[model samples]
Target: MGRMMLKNWLALLTAVFIGLSLAVISIVPPSPQGLDTPDDQFSSARAMVDVRMIAAAPHPTGSEENAKVRTYLAGQLTALGMDVDISASTLPEKALARLNRWSGQSKTEQPIYNVIGVLPGADRTKPALLLMAHHDTVWASPGSADDTVGIASILEIVRAVNETGQPARDLIVLFTDGEEVGLSGARHFFSENPLRNKVGAVINFEARGGGGTANLFQTSEGNGDAARLFARAVRQPSGNSAATYIYRILPNDTDLTPALKGDYAAYNIANIGKAEYYHSPKIDADALSESTVQHMGSQGLDLTRALLSADGFPRKKPDATFFDLFGLWTVIYAPVWGWAFLGVTLLCYILPLRRDMLRKDTLVGAVKMVGFMVIGGVVLFGLNALSGGGSGADYYDRLAAIPRLEAVAGLTIFAVFFGTFGRSQLSENGVLGATLPLFILAVAGQSIAPTATYFISLTVLLCAIATFIRRSKQTETYGQWISAAVAAILIGYMVSFGHLLMLGVGPDLPSVAILPAALAVLAILPLWRGLPKRVVTVASIASLGLAIAIALWIRLDPIASTVPLY
Candidate 1:
């Protein structure tokens, strides 16, 4: 018995380690390329020179520093063999109001200068491809990550394109002013400039944090053709229809917001990591993540090259479902395929059922799984409240606490999982029963939101397969190992997905993590063997204590010194 317990512990530890390792690898951004990298490829070292220059100080609209950055950008574009100009326009009344509030002065001169450059292609008659980024900062922030990184990435992308030779169509570089102040420059240009009519497609770069993998978060309506192009062109892509779906419903806007009004193929890419550094006064070029710059620029270069070489812009088609596979490659397909996946999932679960399996145990398992989700969600909500969430919390301070909050959520979920199921010896039917709730959710999601339902459906399908394998080889030694392998894949994806969710909205909604946590539980259920009651209780208590301690730490810690003052 002692030897058997030791083996079980070892197996569990191995599976967990494998899953965590895969999760870490999936989320890490690519390594930064150096100056020695070929000129034809985008390099962060080349980009950082521009980042350091443009982000040297807060260059808000109408400031002398803003003019200096504008002049420098125009000169660089000219040097890259482009026809460059600075278009000066007055900010609208709404933008002027925001500028006045930020600067604390009512005296009104609302001028914004937008930098425009055109690299004439082999066929100038074809519509132009635009690459855009904002050149302005907020009041006190250096804005190294918020917009400076975006500007620098465009500069690097243009240089690489020049090295390759003229594109099949014109390439337009737009460095808009006053993005931090209501996207004033972009609004003026897209609505009034003659050049807007020339643009066929637009790729806008943006950021919310200092580091992390850049994601293609938003695209224009009917993005099937655009997404397919992106999947084929970007070698190390990171994005999903689910992210685009969520962003569409959120009250968020980037410079792309104004440009989307035009008849153009549009894509918005950004990174959301190191949340504490977003618009922070202390965010400087030296503190920025070079890997993030490389990730953004490399992907940008690939997509630009592909579009510049295509016969014409992608025509509007029904939106497709797509996501990257642990950053290795993208999986894209029509939303209609989701029904087929659901059908297969159902078959996998039903095919392995036996006449001898007890219906009573299956019902109990289903009830327990539902109870776990509800109880876990409540605990997460309570813990988030303790960590200074909900009404009256400082929004920026909560943003700074995202990493710690993610840890608290993860540990709390682990505690809840153990407390709920650690001592239960589930039969094969019981394991299948535990997955019923999530299966139902997947079905509803597929019916109502097919693009976003792939993750849930895929999770159910994988868990069902694991259960079938275990049930078929009940007396075989290698059967559990095979199940463990399947669990590792599912856990890795869930962990990475949960990390992203935390970065995106955990500051306000850590409780939303319950969905991913429940999916992960389905993977673990098939491999679980009941533990001693005392051991289970001790593990649960220890994990819960650690989670609470982290929550208290976040609550008591002072607001980050780097947070913007105004």
Candidate 2:
């Protein structure tokens, strides 16, 4: 009984640690106290002033509100002790026709303005660091989160940088218009403007929702040098190569598109949560998450400061494999090194089995684990379809349903575990069997997409080591401690990974989170032996029932005014 009690306590302790990790990393930095009483510093409080003014009304391209925003932005830049230039162009005739047909308006032309401000460095010879943000909102939406936060962040970043000292190179701020209709403003600036030649690096801030962690999601091709700079410069960095690879395949568009075409290093960062408020009529000053604003500003300020002070911008190099360690520090290596990790995991699994002589029960357990994952994936796909997923569903509506969708997915996985593993006892050999499929999947992932598979391969390697230790004589206590530690790390990493996966592809591919979730659950299987069957069954049913009710609520909820009219 004492041994069983100790096992249960370990389970609880692991869960608490996982929760603590999530809570610490996911929080947006608090608004600085000096914001309102600004004294030559960049503060979200002061930035909020601009966000309020820009997002006070809908300011789509060609609208009077957009013109007002342009004039206001020009005035603000002028007050910042810089010469602000406004480049205005008419929308191409063909694009105007398309917009007319889409909006059912007979408008034949639309005007766009690109605002550029130059704060010359003490030395004028080096290439400039460019800061980019759009200034227009989607039609009928306040758009405080989408680009207003970005615009406000740039203004604040400049304010803070100026207060520190004159930069080593020219600091250019490009606030482009017509971003809502398309990337017209950014395209015009990067393609036609002479200032494009002066730029060596670019940092673009963006948003997809009203709140969530701000992810550094994209970097220039061959970003090894640039990523290293970022990892060293930014505190509490949140990024991974898997996100970069996925973004390459996604059809998403941002102002960074035209910049990427140029010979300049670049970064794209955005927050994606409370997504129902993205581009919605309800996106106002109060609707915006101040913490989200602070988060963006904090990251932008740090990177900008580092770049401005660097001896020279990072030159192009081979891309690096990088991931954050519990949001504390970034670990980077050459992509080719992923093979070493995969080899270690393979050896750990196979050598242990060889020593134990490959029992048949172990093989059976491996098969069952794979079967469990397959069934879980199928259940998630079906539930997602029922929860207004699939191609026919409105993109924004599906985004709004993410919270519910996450719950549904979680409950389904829990239920599957209860019905399958809760009733059965897995001998030591059976436990070894479960690792086989995970090991195979990790190997495949490492070979095909090393960056994406690190979470899988690394966790398996840790668990395999613990398993090996457990098989030793008179070292069972040591093994349990190591296992608990492994579980804690895996669980923490997976929590952040799951949230990011949902944010990046939640509307269409939430089921992908199951891969990490399953691995995390299996990692703690030893402690779970003490978990009661009745407890698992009841919790499973309750969670599933709640998930279904939430799904129904999502379906029944009317289209919020926050969603786009089109």
Candidate 3:
């Protein structure tokens, strides 16, 4: 009984460690400790001054509120010792047509204003780094997170840069209008304006929601040199090449679209948390996350400084393989190096089999584990369809249902894990077997999409090494503790990766999260001597019941006050 109790205690401790790991990775670093030295760097508090005024109302393009925003921006830029230029242009016919389609309006003409400010550098002829954000909000939403954060971040970046003295190259700030309408202001500026010729590179700030990790999502093709600069400059980066690849295929578009068409190096960054508040009427200045604001401003300032000081823009080279390590730092390299990681993990898994002497247990265990992955994935896909994620479900409504959807996903994934693995005890050989499916998947990913798969591949490699260590050690306690620590790190990274994935694609495809969650749980299987089937059953039932309760509550609870008024 005492031994059983000790095992239970260890299990509890392990659970706590995993929780702490997740929390640490998910937190947006708080706004820099104290602003006593505000003059030395970009300050979130100073930036909020602009966010408050700009996000005061729903300032849709061509509205009187938007006009007021334009006036305020011009004055602020002028105060920063910039030569401010405001140009108004009629929205293109295609953009006006889209506006009419989305709003059912019959307006024949729409006007958008573009704001430009220039900070002279020591050298006048050097290609300038263009900083961009759109000032207009959606029709009925304050849009504090949508583009206001971007605009405010740029304003603060400019203020902080001035305090550092002149840059080596010119810094041009572009606050675009009519972004929510259809990137009309950006299209006009990049297509018609003469300033486009002065730009060597571009840094565009944007937001999809009110809070969460600010990610450097998109970069121009041939981002090797550019990504290297970013990795060295940004102190805390929450980005990965996988996301960049995925974003290329997604239908989402931003003001960066028009700019990407030009011969310039471009980077697009955005925060996507508390996504239910996106374009919602409840998005006032107070709703904006101060941590998110700080994250965006700090990363932008760092990258801007780096670009301004460089001899010239990064020369175009092949895309680099990059991802952050536990949100602490970035790891970047050539895609070819992924094979080295894959080869090592393959050897790790293969080497263990020699000791077991081609036993039937290894093969059967591997096949069973593969079955588990397939069954779990299919079940999740089906449940997602039933949980307000069907083909005809309203997109915006699904956005509002995200919290409940997450609960459903959590419960369903746990239930699948219990149902599949509850009855069996995974021996040392069985742990090796479980990694086989992941290894196969990794090879495919490495061959087809190296960047997207490295997170999984590298994670599997670490876990496999932990497994090898567990197998070689005669003492069970040493194996448990050591393997547990490695598992914690692997799980921690996955939790953060999964959160970012959900934020990026949850409304449309939440089931995909099951892959990482299941793999991470399996990575720690060596510690589960035998989680009692009864315990697993009870936990699964309880989680499902709670998930059902949340789903019903979602049906009954009042629509979020933030939901768009329209």
Q: Compared with the true structure, what per-residue lDDT tens digits does model 2 show for residues 301-351?
A: 888988888998888898777887766678888777877877777676666
TM-score of each: 0.97, 0.94, 0.94
Q: Local distance difference test, per candidate?
A: 0.88, 0.79, 0.80
Q: Write the per-residue lDDT of candidate 1 for residues 172-232, one digit (tens) a residue.
A: 9999998988999999889989999999999999998889889999999899999999999
What would the C-alpha RMSD of candidate 1 be, to one decimal place? Answer: 1.7
Which residue pairs collide, candidate 3?
Answer: none
Model 3, which residues run further than 4 Å from truth? 1-12, 15-19, 32-37, 98-105, 355-357, 473-477, 555-559
Residue pairs in collision within model 2: 280-562
Q: Lowest lDDT 10-mer window, candidate 2?
A: 26-35
